[model samples]
Target: MAGYLTTHVLDTARGCPAQGIQIALYRVSGNSHKKIATAETNADGRTDAPILPEGKFAVGTYELIFFCGDYLRATGQTADDPLFLDQVPIRFGVSDGAAHYHVPLLLSPYGYSTYRGS
Candidate 1:
């Protein structure tokens, strides 16, 4: 079996999956950045398919930009106050292309966290 990239989002404040959140993946090389994929979170806060399919995995720096501010506004949250966390960018490296990368986000109105999962 080959490797692939996957992600999920949890809205900690709402205590549910963050559906409809937009995310973009970028391959970073020094001062340059190349966008590889774009996806939206499903009802379960996951994409319909892998962000990076098996054969596409590479050893390099990558970034996932989660559109947090837009998601909050769309979900009926007031934007009267400045959002502490807006677009959350999680940058990581893929050292082994043969290994599955499961990056998940636990998000809230004020903060967010991510980790490499199985």
Candidate 2:
């Protein structure tokens, strides 16, 4: 089977899925960054479809930027003028074109974490 890219965001501080967070996917080559896909998390904290679907799968470095600032303010999780953690970017590589890639974000008002999830 061919591979694709998927992701989700969980609001750790609120103990629930982070809805309406905007996410952008980009292909990174040296000093060049090209945006390839974008989506907003739904009520389930996930995009309705794969950010990078199978036909567009590639083997190289990529970045997923999670726009969390608005979500924080909407959910009343932040009161600072500028949040310590706002736009979270996770950079990773896909060496295999035939494997699934799941990058999930566990987030809070002050911190965030990610992993190669299934």
Score each candidate by Cα lDDT: 0.91, 0.96
The local distance difference test score of model 2 is 0.96
> lDDT: which candidate is best?
2
Task: Itemize residue pairs with steric clashes in candidate 2.
Answer: none
For model 2, the superposed segments whose C-alpha errors exceed 4 Å read: none
Q: What is candidate 2's lDDT per residue for 1-118, written digit by digit as tens?
A: 9999999999999899999999999999999999999999999999999999999998999999999999999999889987888899999999999899999999999999999998
Clashes of each: 0, 0
The worst-scoring run of ten residues by lDDT in candidate 2 lies at 77-86
lDDT of 1 at 55: 86
lDDT of 1: 0.91
- Candidate 1, residues 1-118: lDDT per residue as tens digits? 7778999999988999999989999999998999999999999999999999888888899999998888888887657467777789999999988899999999987778899999
Question: Which 10-residue span in candidate 1 carries the lowest summed lDDT?
Answer: 76-85
